[model samples]
Target: MLQMDPMRPLDPALPITPQLTQRLRDRIIRNHLKPGDRISETEIAKVYDVSRQPVREAFIKLADQGLLLIRPQRRTVVSRIAYQDVLDARFLREAIEADIVRLLAKTRDDALIGTLRAQIELQKRVHADDLETFTQLDEQFHRMLADAVGKAGTWSFVEGVKAQMDRVRFLSLFDYPMALLIEQHTQIVDAVEARDLDRAEENARQHLRLMLDYLPGVIAANPSFFDLPEGGLAPSVNTPTLGGEYT
Candidate 1:
């Protein structure tokens, strides 16, 4: 189908095109819209109750994010999940966030800890079924860490480079228990508070790798949604494991 499932309806927190774009992007990230599925401006416009102009604009925005492949004089299709893209994102995030945690570990910021703990508490209140809120708070927790370390711009850069990884992450969240992720965040807070650089870094690394552990099952569930990892002989799903290349 052209349109995909939404965690909920569009928030309308922004303008028409931006709002529609966010809705469509959320669907793409969550795997409600599988790769290679054709979607058109008219189709989406009708659904969002917006004009074709805004919908067309939304398509361009999504295309920029690597979520939509826009072809001239043809319908836009959701892009395939390239395993290499996911790996790149994971590697980059591990590099950036682990250091952010390290920096925060050196400083004494009770306010920062309180803020992170608040986000975690909010996460705790989010029902297991509330993927939308869970995802928002998840992003907030990470972004807040960057802010605490005066690396908010760095976090934005990491986000810019990791669009593909973000999509893979959201898709994989379906299989992972959110509660476990929350607990991991709690451990990270504890490690940082204790000024345990090694422990904090390890926690960050493990938390990022959590998605890789779930990738095989995502591929198994929706093979069409993914592509082979770079330099790999074949897609891992058909193999015994995802292979050491990911490690």
Candidate 2:
């Protein structure tokens, strides 16, 4: 059993499985339950004061997400980060969001621009150590862009694919370049405001690719957290042309 702080009591009215799944996911991503750490349904049930059935279901859900590895009559351990999964997630995001920004740039909407700028302001105010709040705001910032262009469902798809990237992100937050990211956000907003479709697309692509630049350092610093071996090759991705047609 992993020793940690007591969980806050779950509400009786809510469904326990989804809540438990999400909380457990957060624990894994935030490193409270680290990679390769063995966790058991029986032990988790004891911590949450819930029955093992819900805990088992929750574990299965996370297993499907590649966060847990369940085995018969063996200890279940947290999955290490898959470098390819992270790259694939970034590729999908860059493809989807590049088009999203281009569409938003084609039309000038002061209201949308204002909302995004306000979001950046809020992001700036987050304390450097408050990564959880910053992460939420960051998601909101991108989701708002997709929502503005009536592509909320498309953004939902992005969310589904980005879990692997999120784990890497949370781990990298200790040395996160918050100011640089905020500046990138500002540039993205500025491009859209100016109706620079190509620039907006480019800005979005560059922002999404920041992980590509930092991932190597992160892997080196915490080799045990990732599945990629030392000297493993990162995936090579072709840069998409600005305003390129989506296949």
RMSD of each: 5.1, 2.6
Question: Worst lDDT window (10 residues) for model 1?
Answer: 236-245
Instruction: Report the Cα lDDT for candidate 2.
Output: 0.87
- Global lDDT of each candidate: 0.79, 0.87
What is the TM-score of candidate 1?
A: 0.80
Worst 10 residues of 2 by lDDT: 238-247
Q: Put down candidate 1 lDDT per residue, 197-236, tens digits, no spaces.
A: 8788778877887877787777687676777755542432
Query: Using Cα atoms with residue i matched to residue i, what is each candidate's TM-score against the true structure?
Result: 0.80, 0.91
* Candidate 1 regions with alpha-carbon error over 4 angstroms: 1-16, 49-54, 229-247
lDDT of candidate 2 over 1-247, digit per residue (tens): 5654565877769999998888888888787888899999889888888999999999998998889999879889999988888888888899899999999999879998999999999999999988889989998999999999999999987876677888889889877789999999999999999999989988998898888878888888888898883578656483566555431
lDDT of 1: 0.79
**Which pairs clash (backbone N, Cα, C closer than 3 Å) in model 1?**
none
